[model samples]
Target chain A: MSITSFIPPQRTLMGPGPSDIYPQVLQALSRPTIGHLDPLFIKMMDELKQLLQYAFQTKNTFTIAVSAPGSAGMEACFVNLVEAGDKVLVCRNGVFGDRMRENVERCGGIAIMVDNAWGEPVSPALVEQALQTDPDIKIVAFVHAETSTGALSDAKTLAEIARKYDCLTIVDAVTSLGGVPLLVDEWQLDAVYSGSQKCLSCVPGLSPLTFSEQAIAKIQQRKTPVQSWFLDQSLVLGYWSGEGKRSYHHTAPVNSLYALHEALVLLHNEGLEQAWQRHHRAHLELKTGLEALGIQFVVEEAYRLPQLNAVYIPEGIDDAAVRSTLLERYNLEIGAGLGTLAGKAWRIGLMGYAARNENVALCLKALESTLK
Target chain B: MSITSFIPPQRTLMGPGPSDIYPQVLQALSRPTIGHLDPLFIKMMDELKQLLQYAFQTKNTFTIAVSAPGSAGMEACFVNLVEAGDKVLVCRNGVFGDRMRENVERCGGIAIMVDNAWGEPVSPALVEQALQTDPDIKIVAFVHAETSTGALSDAKTLAEIARKYDCLTIVDAVTSLGGVPLLVDEWQLDAVYSGSQKCLSCVPGLSPLTFSEQAIAKIQQRKTPVQSWFLDQSLVLGYWSGEGKRSYHHTAPVNSLYALHEALVLLHNEGLEQAWQRHHRAHLELKTGLEALGIQFVVEEAYRLPQLNAVYIPEGIDDAAVRSTLLERYNLEIGAGLGTLAGKAWRIGLMGYAARNENVALCLKALESTLK
Candidate 1:
């Protein structure tokens, strides 16, 4: 029943997420708690929305953070936009893409799946073929940055394909948002969801979501009400949308939002382009170091995400054992490949604060020693 | 868009739900982020479950924190247990109880509501009467602490009533868990949900939940699958149960869970009896101080919640002005009444670390000075 004060070891977090948190973001987490509806807090909320729009490179008014993780962001987007019996085209190239199919099915939407190789990016050509087969598809869903494999799909190309088929787009930018380029408006992405912890360098909890005006129109025109009342955007907007007369959807996680606001501020401070370049630089350094150690990346260079590098595990090395030793001895963290790639690869993240020269150097040196 | 670092003012929070956070809890929030499924993190998760069970006074195998807020916990409980067309008797005393009804309706369950006054405890007799009238009621739902109006319902009596009527119980102890004594096993409560911010003094995000053997059995025996794939207890338990091969759920908020673990540890360290006594002592002291300032409590003394005190807006006094002045001049926070009691009463909370002689004295002094 007793516990020790958490004295966290200084781990070089090169995992898919909760990639190393910036010290400023940590300080933001410790700010004094405030009422969610406090005027000052509400002001911060408005600013947060604008900053998110900047990060997403969109001007949509519906941009806001869901009071849950990125998975709930997936749920919220589907539950609010897709009503019963609607046909949704879900393209799966990784675990998160499959999760999109699950969301579609759970929303009572008929899912038309377009499959792609596990570590490869979603094939726009395959998706176009699926659209041709299922012209009735109302929505097209895919993961832009597939966390399970360090693959970056051509989100713009996929959105264009969906547009040609007259289907709305639901893009998962959970691992891509601040670390890479995202053009929500330019790509005409209908609904996009991202997580705070991944590239935002915030504490995990809030999921930033932005819906194009077209998606809002779809939600408003739904024949049946949203099945999950808690996630029903219509009602939730009353709480998160306007000023002065905000309705209570639920008690907003007040302090968590503060941390998010601070994270977004940090993002703005660094500039999105700068953050992206930082990730790319870190990944290049890590890749060079890792290749020197005879490690091969699972994802092809053209489609690979700079933030998350999927390296093939060396033969005769136990994936779990190596990870455990690094955690126990070196306090270094790297992600294991998910699903089909499990036991064959390690996902070394270069995201946010984790996407730095020092962390990359530390991970390579520690990994080298651990491998030896 | 530019944003200043969100510098939270050092305020003495006496709000309805986010009762002031402890400094230790704030420090915990700033701890380094870790992977949700890391071995050390999973070890911490196991310890957290034990601490939560102690706070909830339950030995249920299904006790763990949901990755989202208390509302998600509420949704998880209803979505997982009450399948489509299940007859659920929802007892409404305040905002949260109404939320349960919304959850039931959303999940396609028929909600038979037993409504009560906002500032009064849920009448056990009324719930019993409703259950008797509706024999098909599979679950009876109620809130232990009506945060909107500082009312304390007889959760034990209601659970017993539900048992007599052959219905399972789902209790919302969101604001009662660590502040008031919640005997989950003694009452034979089927499912219970709570928040981290209220009495736990942790940064808000994680929702602690416990389900008895009976609830788990019901989940297993349900004819239809749970509506929400995200909240399905079967899948979630595979992750939080810490037994066998752990299936991955959504990425858990790693640092927030650390904060919760620390809060629970703090609670158990103080011991439940002493925690309850501390709340009672602070409430009594606050009451005496407020009485000296000529304020009247909204709820009947016998049914008043020690953690949340709803006081009437005195004649000839401007409630908004008083609160504003308190915030501007004294850096203090107190909640405005919600729902029917909105603008009519002021909610003063003294919960967890906030339920101390120092906080009580400070809040009382601030109120007195502001009134003058």
Candidate 2:
């Protein structure tokens, strides 16, 4: 039980996330632990904000990680911006969108639902119709990459539609950022939240969030105070804001930030376009192999996310048994279907460092053997 | 921009939490990413809960980590347990205790402040006096080890007093859990929250929380629903209850839990009594060395926490400059004074893996060099 120095086995991560962490990111994580408010670490925080902005593809000055998980980032957005009695349209196509509705209701906002089938993308037309009916809706939220079903919605078109209706848009890019194309500025998205473990290949703790100036303006104009003080952006900005006079918020997961920096730097080096291409390439390779093994995708070809592929479980195949076999026999890991798709589908993620040729081959072979 | 996979320079980590991570903990963190709800991962979760119970020295069945940092753990305890109009007594002696007041007020509870000076323990006599004055108080809250000021309160006495007054106790043991002698069962504590980083020596993110049966029953019988859905134990328990049928909560930070599990295993290997003795031994050694160097501890010796020592800055010396020089020159990290003690003291942490003879020596030598 006295732990010796670590020697990590090289893994081919094709699960939801934490995808295979880059060796460099791991090294960054093991660096010296410094105070969250230390000047050197604060300097790193500034660089992190800049890197997050680049990854988010936004010029918004408020881009930073909430010192918790993607769920907290989602909570921070809703608690600060959604005041009581505000009508918010939550487009539920998967688990994360439903979480958005929960956030809205918890914040005392009236949740106006726009339901889409679980495996399908969020229909821009449905969102538009909801907005037309609820003209007073303040926020329209949807998932960009629905991890549950590997569906990619039209976030750009949805944001444009929200703009047309004069409602702000909140996009959950938890599974999409860095792996796919996300044009926050071009799409005119107001608020977006992402997880580090997904496409970013960083340790999971800090969640990256970005807000447009208009979103900040809305937060400032809120009448009722945000319910959670730790998540209130008005105060959190004091710590994450790079200016010399940073106030104390909760301690930023300091070492976690280092992992994020290294991940973002890795993304930049690969280039956004190349990163997107890499995911698509890996996805196609995985798809071809799985298809050859008689697997059918849950989401249709056009709407499928390259990073996460939800596939139907073959008839008579026990989902739990297959997954257990994969883990015990091959040390392979993949996601189970969530919500409506539970027991009927499997989610295979090709993300960040996990999206490699070898990972695709290993997953397919292990899954094939388990199915047999 | 690619990471070089450089090895870490072994240093004596004698700072705040995120102290030195054990090598095994890092290896666990680098383990293959598995689905959050994978059966094997669920098995790991169950083991983690048991390990947390051992670390907490409790038989509470409701022990689990809030999938966030210590701040979110504080928020979870307050938001779930304290409803609107609930009168809660909060003892404020340091930064974290003040944070509890913020959480109480944010959750719409009336905060009855039991004030204590910074660097001082919460006066039990004062708390008893307040309880007598406000007999309707529902919750009594205080920090066990004040990380910011290094003041350790008498949690056993405080919990007993709260129980006598028929009020639930919410204890913050963020800095005390593994490093100090804690008796959750013996103390009959109700709701306790702790950090993974502090004495646990895990990376930051997970916050271990335990609720006594009474606390759980109160939460179950609450008239008003917990406002924050993410922190609601009712919903979260379904995911972490370790039952055969586990529900999916928001994706748990997978690898961080692995690191925590390893840290707990390491602690279990070195029995809790031995761990406590190690912290005490290191504290005694550190105190002797600091006194030799003409330094003074802020708290009285009788009330001092073994893991965290707050030393007053010498008059006319730039406290920030010395810390900056130490960090920049020797790559040594230490905490600065917070709140009322800002610019007046430095918090030196002898936490978990950082609690060793060599770290104490390094800290003292580094201080001497910085002063010179």
Calculate DockQ per candidate and list them. 0.70, 0.40
Tens-digit lDDT track of model 2 for A209-271: 999999999999988889988789999888888776789777667667788888988888788
Question: When only chain A is evaluated, what TM-score does every model earn?
Answer: 0.98, 0.97
What fnat does each of the candidate structures reach? 0.65, 0.31
- Whole-model lDDT, model 1: 0.88
TM-score of each: 0.97, 0.95
The runs of at least 3 residues in candidate 1 whose Cα sits more than 4 Å from the true structure, single-residue gaps closed, are none
Model 2 CA deviation exceeding 4 Å by range: A1-11, B1-12
Model 1, range B1-372, lDDT digits (tens) per residue? 557887767877788767788888888878888787777788888898888889999889899998888988998889888988899999898888888998999889999999998888999889878887879998999999988888999988999999998889999999999988899999899999999889888877778999989899999998977767778889899998778667788888888888898888888888999999999999999999999999999999999999999999888888889889888888778888888888889999898888989988888898888788
